[model samples]
Target: MHPATATPTHCPYCALQCGMNLAPGRGESPLAVEERADFPVNRGALCGKGRTAPALLSSRVRLTEPLIRSHATGRLEPATWEEALDTVAEGLDRNRRAHGADAVAVFGGGGLTNEKAYALGKFARVALGTSQIDYNGRFCMSSAAAAHQRAFGLDRGLPFPLADVPRTGCVILVGSNLAETMPPALRYLTELKENGGTLIVVDPRRTRTAEQADLHLAPRPGTDLALALGLLHLVVAEGRTDEEFIAGRTTGWPAARAAAMAHWPEHVERVTGIPVPKLREAVRMFCAPESAMVLTARGPEQQSKGTDTVGAWINLCLATGRAGRPLSGYGCLTGQGNGQGGREHGQKADQLPGYRKLTDPAARAHVAEVWGVDPDTLPGPGRSAYELLDALGTDTGPRALLLMGSNPVVSAPRAGHVEERLRALDFLAVADVVLSETAAMADVVLPVTQWAEETGTTTNLEGRVLLRRRALTPPPGVRSDLDVLHGLAARLGPGQGHPDLEKKFPTDPAEVFAELGRASAGGPADYAGIDYGRIAREDGVFWPCPTPGHPGTPRLFLDRFATEDGRARFVPVEHRAAGEEADAAYPLLLTTGRVVAQYQSGAQTRRVDELNAAAPGPFVEVHPRLAESLGAVEGQPLAVVSRRGRAVAPARITDTIRADTVFMPFHWPGEGRANTLTNPALDPVSRMPEFKVCAVRVETVDAAGRDTTPSTGAETADAAA
Candidate 1:
């Protein structure tokens, strides 16, 4: 490839996957980004993280060579790729010899391209013959996915494209702070308002996105399910539901409606702390419109009751006949860059290449034949991401682990404990572009190629499969993730011990994608017809694109749901308190989220000078009244302690949040690590950790480390009253 050519690509950040052109830099310089105006998703818009993405590619921050931890010195030292690969292979084989194949686990990331995700899953099953494989995406939107699958019979983040937002009559956005998390996508909501459509934002705090809403319902932390049920109750009581539509297109609505009726407005107000009048107004605004949509994000999905909470919201949509209709449906704002694709293409614990259930004999047979393996050889389903990590270093857990693209040390809930688990692993190998917090603890760290240095395909939030072309060659010693997988598979396969395993893994992305298409031929997330050529010819193609001549399905469930009966199922759900509730010892609720300037875990973005300057460090956002009671002032250090651990950050007093709640951004590690205090209570169905709400108490600290009582401000009297 020539240095001056511009390669069309997508941002390596959020699910929005804002399109951009990577212009090759002159003579050894890194690639520079240019506006990709033709791409419909973002048009020409790019966020701060997207604009400065190339900064992480600088030689100063990027790892150019493999690092091996020396036992004698207890320090990581540079080594040739050959030596590092050999060490990793030897360690993994030794662990497999002692423990079973399940004792060697693999952890994938949501940021990987679809090919890489597909290859990683195949590598775990065919190469290592291990069932213990999962990814960080389990923590992102599994709850929403489970809810979507239960309600709609399929799990595509958004049933319709972002362009429909402006045309919709009303949209109830639950728990997403698009203004900060996804700035480019915020324009869609802005356009909706400009188009005279109503926007209702539901969150515990009055976020930047909520400020622009026609109605902002600030519920208590972890009370979103109750709030949703309350709205549905109002809808049913006021006869706002589409009885005809529900009767025609949905099933099990009678039970769902009965459940909603149980949660009256007054009872919901007591549970969620939102007045009954506001609930009524919200229902009126949503139902008065001809069509409306309900969208959820991490806030409602990252709870112990996440699946049911999201189900409640979906039930609201079903009762109101908002789904499976033009311009109205249920959607999830996927968080990670490739969170949508990562789950669909086999990296998930229980999924096959095409989002097929691993337990299904037919699905297993299809993918097995595609991989040139026997169906029976494939291992059964395994634990989810958090459960896999939790089992590490334990007697029944995997003895060795191979991780790529994820930094769970700073990102996982109860992260302090996860860090301990990582430290206890007998052999840990990590492949990443930078030395992340988790990578630094690994025995062998393999340098891998990044976004512009590799060519692959990714399915965005809209289920649109887009191609990311290679713009430049990677620096010496850095290889693509596929190369690493290929080497490992070659070393671990037939030549080493198992004679049957031979040349099963492919290093080329296109070749792997071709195999993926075959594996996904008739699965739910069917991509049998999508190829790199089709992606390049057209801007992108939506999935369930089964044949070459068939146009892709842009909107799902328009004619009928994916269920066997061709009808949407409404799962009855009721409100429940959060996993951890406020008590005397910990009399406040704590929540965590992202800041505009930093990406997840802050592994790459923290290395960027501009991003670091913008969001220097983490802080606790406390309500002004809470700050007054805690004797904590703005800029003063506060120690937020939970049952799990404690994290100290400077207090940032704001009235935007509720008086009994505190918010923290989980991008930093050590003293500012919000995950340190987060609860790891898992949702029964989704296995999602309760990162949204945990019980914690905030106390002021003096410069000398002594605790001090909060001094009451004169202005706090009225606010507290």
Candidate 2:
């Protein structure tokens, strides 16, 4: 590809996968982006993060050389790629010799391309012979994934294309601020309203997306489960359920229905803080529509009861005959760029390629055959993400870790503790394009190529697998992740008693993808028919494409669910409080989320001056009543203390949030790092941490050493300021 020639590709940010044309820079300059209007998902729409993604390619901020920490000086210095790779191998081998193969672990991220995710999983089991491997997607959408698997029999972020949202009669968007997190997607909601359809927004905060809703229900934090059950209760109370649909297309509805009936309108209002009239109105609008949908994001999914909470919402959709039909179903708005694809491949702890269960003998045989390895050699399911991170440095934990593309030091719940675990590791190797907070702690850091500097494939939120073309040459000393994996495999395989590195761990993306396709053949997330050529030719191909001549499946479960009986299963569920709740000691509920200007961990976005200016640092969004009670004023520093830790940020009092709760964005590190105060209580099924809700107490700090209440009222204070 010529430097000036433009190559069509997708954004490097969220899963919307908005298409863009990457115009290579002149001479040694970075790539420039232009809208590629041909892609259906976003058309020509792009968010600020998508537009400014190229800014990260600048050489000044990007890591161009491998770094190894010096033992004597305790500082990182530039080193040859050979030295870094050898050091990593030595450390991993030392740990394996002392402990066992399980003492060496691999941690992956949802941002990695499909090829990388596939290869990383293989490298862990084949080369390192370790069953301990998982990815950050566990924290992203595991709850929604678990719920979907239980309800619809398989998990795809959205069963139908986003294009169908506009045609739906009504949509209940639960726990997502699409306007800020995914700006391009907001247009679909706009179209939904323009088509005379109703939109009900559910959240604890009245976000930008909520402002546009026909009916915005501001519930208390950690009470989304009750709210969902309450809606289903209304459906049954009003005699609005589709008895035919439930009887024919579903099973176990008797138990699920009884569970919903337990959550009456009055009890639900008391739990969720949404008025009874509003709940009734929401039920009326949702059930009245001919076709309706329920979409959930991290809000309801990142909790101690997330899977069941999401199940409650799916039950509501199933009861109303809104699922498995045109423009009607339950879906999840996956956050990360490759979150959908990341979980589909073999990176997840409990899954093989094609979303096959690791514990299944048949699944192990199929994937092992594709990899030219014995089925018995393939390791069984490992620990979940939080569990793996938590066990690090302990007697039962992995002594060495290879982390790629994840900044858990800033992104994990109770991050202060995660950071402590990372520090306790005997050996830590990180591969990334930049020196992230997590990478800064690593013993050896390898510089890897960024988005436009590599060619690979990623599945978007719509299950559309699109190829991201290499538009520019990487800066000197930096290499692609595939190259890094290949180098490590070659060095580790012969010494670690694994098979030939060349055949088992190919560096070429196409070759790896071909092997992945074979491994995925006949599986739930089957991608046997999808190829690089087909994806480029068709713009993108939806998965479950099993054969060459077969067209990809854009919508799933239209004819039948993926379950053995071809019927959706309803899991009975009830509302429960968050893992940690408000009490006398900690009187306010604290929730965390994203800001429009920054992405997760802010490793790349924070380096971009434009985005940093938009959201310089975190601030507490406290309601006026809470601020008054705490004697805190706008722009004044306030300490939010929880049992785990304390995070101090400038106060921004607003009525958008509930008086009994406070909110913070979990993008930055340091004192403003919200995850520091978050609870790590995991959801039993999904293992998702309760990032959405925790108990905390707010204390005002005096500039003049006085603990007196603020003389000015919240009415005169500017929250946005």
Candidate 3:
């Protein structure tokens, strides 16, 4: 029953991880993308980025050689893999000998394959004996991760399967831009809206999703917690609470209810800048008692109070007893391809594999056994990403750092500070597929294979683990991230090599998937009995497939909660202001986000000529009234400055943005990185910086200056500060 020709497939661009088939065409490369129907997430839908992935994959800027920076002249020169690896090993060894294992920190990216992520964490803890490791997932979804673990005992990236969206009655989207970033997933929204289910959206900006909403609540930035609390108050006040569900399957009701009631409609209206009438309407439409769901994304979780904000959404779900029902519950909109899977497998600072906390002794023991190391040998949780960077700036911190697949200089919050720290490092080794801004300052740059050249597993937005197969081999001299780590670990010490490394870290992804399944057996995200053979037999299995004969779980919390008492407890949230606020001195609120033409930090999409031409350079979006007040016109250059730093970009006059605030995309830097003007203040709970809000003042570049419309043939020229 073999097919006539082998089909080439790869995960779609962006975080959805929707699979695609590539049938070779006339004059096309061996791995040309061809969208196919029947993929669970996409169902044949593709976005601008997904359809144009070929240009990105075959970009001319892709790095293919190992680069070594000369310590004396500060110049990067090409080197053989042996020289690069040897230099990196020597630097790491020297760091370990000087400041103990804790002094060496490792930073990972969410874009990496699961095998590479798992290897990075294990490599740091076992071979190098350093617990100072964390990933960029902290900035994207740590709040969601913390809340999901507390409520469901395990965080499913997408707890409910994507297919369940069409059958749902109502959807409450908070802080998610599915319409633009992930246009394919919006099919369910369109279907639900067409079928008469209310589509309520809450965000600071009236995004495309908000514009299509039956009700859109434009709350001030960082006031989401207040609105969520008020919504719960209304649900309880209107007697819409599901007492039967709560009584049968939940705990901690009294405290949660009292706390929610503390913020009434009028109280929250004043604090959140959402009108009382609109707040009442949103709650009334959402408390339908059946087929109601609440979803939160980076909007709520990217603030300084992200954890509390996420907790507010979770508490609202619990108070209304909307959880554990079909088409109902709290859903997190993850930002990376494998952000959920990365957090689940202990890539975060405070967590272990399986969403287990670092302080959990039993979980540590289990993971230690799986890693083939003594439980006591595993160091405690290390510093978070922000804290790690701050530490690097201090004299008594890590002098050497290993960065993989991340461009922190342009991506991190308060990037000016991060750039300073990067320059301060005595030794830095970067492993990536390209020479990113961060790589330009590294002591050693290891050219590593990208997603299309690697085979592994990545859990999608819905916590569905799928196989990511390689259809094309990497260019010569480029190695898989796993192989690079393996080589580095083997050279670390005389006897520090992984015993099962050969069997588990093979080039074939099936073996790695088997090892992951074995480690996950009987655990929270159990996939023990489902191996490559079983998965191939079926199309793709969802998590919790504990045994061979069992069907995968499509939805969670159906019968009972994962807690010991079979109950989901509610955690109350209080309103808090952003870390920075607008005042007379700093009159306008500055916010940052992604443009449809670019992705995060613009590391990949900017390389695509067409997409880059569409969103050429950094620009400040201002309402017409604000532009007039500042003596600015369309295409005019403007200076946006905050307490941290300043950046100059062209001004666009549009009513799409609020008059009191300015919007800018964080994709471009060296010219104008938004992080330069962003607040680095950490969220009290999640430690995520406030990329969403800061106080700033804008000024026109010239008294009679006007903006120039960039043509498709070129990008906007960078303005000299």
Highest TM-score model number? 1
| Residue-wise C-alpha lDDT for candidate 1, range 1-721, written one tens digit per residue | 4457788899989998899998865443477889999999999999999998988777899999999999899999999988998899888889988998999999999999999999999989988889999999999999999999998889999999999999999999999999999999999999998999999999989999999999999988899999999999999899888999899999999899999999999999988889899999999999988999999999999999999999999999989989999999999999999999999999899999889999999999989988888899899999999999999999999989999999999999999999999989999999999999999999999999998889998889999999988888888889999999888776777545665453677788999899899899999999989889999989999998998888999999999999999999999998988999987677788899999999999999999989999999999998877776767879989888899998889999998988878899999988889999999999999999999999888888889765675442223322432
Ten residues in sequence with the least summed lDDT for candidate 3: 712-721
Misplaced by over 4 Å in model 2 are 26-29, 703-721
| Residue pairs clashing, model 1 | 494-498, 630-710, 631-710, 631-711
Model 2: weakest 10-residue lDDT segment is 712-721
The estimated TM-scores of all candidates read 0.98, 0.97, 0.93
> Poorest 10 consecutive residues of model 1 by lDDT?
712-721
Number of backbone-clashing residue pairs for each candidate, in the order shown: 4, 0, 5
Compute the lDDT for candidate 2. 0.90
Residue 141 displacement (Å), model 2: 0.5
Model 3 CA deviation exceeding 4 Å by range:
1-8, 25-30, 495-508, 703-721
* TM-score computed on alpha carbons, candidate 3: 0.93
lDDT by candidate, in order shown = 0.91, 0.90, 0.76
